[model samples]
Target: MHYSFSKDFFWGAATSATQSEGRVEGDRKGENIWDYASKEYNHRFFDGVTTEQTSRFYEDYQEDIQKMADLSFNSFRTSISWSRLIPDGVGEVNPEAVVFYNQMLDELNAKGIQPFINLYHFDMPMKLQEIGGFENREVIQAYKKYAETCFELFGDKVAYWFTFNEPMIPAEAGYLHDRHYPYVVDFKRAAQVLHHIVLCHCEAIKSFREGGYSGKIGIIMDVIPVYPRSQHPADLYAAEMADLFYTKSLNDVILKGFYPEEIGEILRKYDQLPVVTTADKELLSATKIDLLGINYYRPRRVKARESVPNPEGVFSPEWFYDNYEMPGRRMNTSRGIEIYPKGLYDIAKKIQNEYGNIDWFVSENGIGIQDEEQYLQDDMVQDDYRIEFLEEHLSWLHQAMEEGSNCLGYHMWTFVDCWSWINAFKNRYGFYRMNLETGEKTVKKSGLWFKDVIENQGFDKNN
Candidate 1:
């Protein structure tokens, strides 16, 4: 290989419990917000498919981990379902759930694969959601208990622990846009939820440290680098504001242990500032993370808004900037998201220059192709486009690493084709293609190419 990565670089794929583990209601798994919402609003999901119709990882984890080994993965990222681990989200730990998770962890360890476990991934226990979820401080305490339980149970085998996956998504989708469960279109509630989530994360970190666990704990953020639509000063300012509101707001609190002053000013102006107690502030300041996980899919292109928002309207992030669709930009038609590989490089450079050059990794990055069956050839899905997408993104990541960025790994979005929130299985994002109807899995062409990339420690474009 012409290009190679460090010997310790992690090469693996990621999946969430809600998206991949099928036995949603079984094995003492209590109902989560996804289960309740999918049933009540079945029309919202594609093909009326529910979370119950996932990849059956609960029962097939052995075969799945073997497949992961087949793909030459040294580290795998997955989440522990809070509701599954502690039914009703609080008091008692389910014995069956414990058995299953222990077995899964043991199996991965036996195969020489490191497990990176995340605590939350948008699957809030319904019991917690019944009382305003993260909006109430009581729920934050409950989440701390849950996180502590997870550490006490599995911290020995899992070295990397993440408090939340895409933490901003819950605040934005559930509160601002009404795209997720407990949908409420209130700006103040969204701000409060974001605040409580950060506090809860700190509490978890505090608990982990208090327990004397040796593992590294962090948060996984979806980092979308914001770009100005043009060289105009207005557009540049718009991009700056967009980045502060969307990306820096959460990251600063986690990395710097304080909310960005610009974000606080905007929130105060709108009278949407969250209630941050002095104790909470001190707690945040004391707990710092050992690693950062960044999920990059696309860049946010923005321009200055032509008109100011009405003062009487509810505060929103879009008030200062407008999303701009740049002409001639490459688009992923399958997922309706722009394909911008350079955004990864931009994010790495920002972390290197601004965020203390912390140890980090590409926790999630991949392409999703709708109706990918047409590309099948000789039992393997010929996903050459997906391969190209990986190559382009990894090339940028390699360049960033060479430039002194402390990036440690790269993990694609998924291991197998699994159910997405509302999209269900509409868009396939997997190295191994799963026959949803038959529960069969076949490695795709991208999977084979990735095997070579792993074995060689890199890929050669000129090959």
Candidate 2:
């Protein structure tokens, strides 16, 4: 591989507070949905158990930051648990939480690793979850308050801010797919949840502005490009619809200040369009972000199928389109997602052409495998497949830059192996493996390769 990113490129890695931290039930930290969901779904997790040590970032930030700096990374992205900051979801900051986060940020800064702080990362406070979580309009106000508190407290040290990380997933997974907490199969509730989440993002952006935080604020959305299975008109149409609902619905509102016309039609077709109040629209229209974080994982393959009416299965985005498996497509180690690296460039191109020029980054991109150790040997995980995964993606990203995309940075899905919700320890996507049994860390060969890429600004063909 041979490549050269811009001299000012922000190269780093990412992790979430809930996914990587395990001191969840201590220091007056309120229970988050993940905390309860992990226990409730423990039987489904790996080894018929749930995670207890979970990367141990809470007790080992010093070591973690040391490794991150050693990797030559310039930035580290993580989220702050809202419930940890305000145990009741509003008012009264927990001094312990404040001290912990302050220390973490200060440590990263001292190591020359800029912190990109995300306000929410799918860990809703149990109290808020009891009140219907994102489905309830009241939670939007609560989220705005939480955002304001974060800006007021950490704004100075943390200049890069994200309002929500993959807000769409929770809405769909928790409500429609019944895969996450508060598992309810309700399409109407999903639509309402989606609307409320989007409103919360916009309100948080406004709150940052009102709180006088003169820093960049944005939201990270997971966008998997959709490819029609064939050029057939129906397949093409269905693929377009899938793209609108899965990737563009939330993004359209954030970037364009309104929902896409096709999405509106789909919503109305199902009679599930959210009852948008005048105030909601006003706030959404007025609240614009300073940046956008594009998290591209894979592309969707869609084909036309006979529409079957389902009166009770809970309407889903897939109901609006038929999903297809592309014949002989390159599959990831997970065997569920396809490897389509060009999707990243397509995403960058879309942002450049449709959404006005804005600062952006690949906030989340990585490959996952069932057994990472199977690919390891001699004190190193020789993940050549993983290397290929990243190199192919970056090649397209380089093309996007040459064609005029203001992409500022690229961060992988994680810095270390951590617990994934139901997936548990089933899949690993870390450059450095974390030993859950002992909370020890070891760098893989890919980690060394990444350090070279960071130092040289890209891959070196001669190497």
Give the number of the best model, judged by lDDT.
Answer: 1
- Can you tell me which runs of candidate 2 are displaced by over 4 Å? 24-26, 48-51, 461-463
Over 1-463, each residue of candidate 1 has an lDDT whose tens digit, in order, gives: 3668987899999999999997744588998999899899999899999988999999899999999999899999999999899879999999999999999999999998999999999999999899889988899989999999999889888999999999999999999988998888888899899899998899999999989998899999999999999999999999999999889898888899888888888888878898988998898889899999999999899999999898887788989999999999999998888999999999999999999999999999999999999999898999999999999999888999999999999999889999999999999999999999899999999999998999889989753
Clashing pairs in 1: none
Residue by residue across 319-428, what tens digits does model 2's lDDT show? 76887887888888584888899999999988998888677999999988888888778867788877778888888998899889999999987799888877877788
Compute the lDDT for candidate 2.
Answer: 0.84
What TM-score, over all chains together, does every model reach? 0.98, 0.96
In terms of TM-score, how similar is model 2 to the real structure? Answer: 0.96
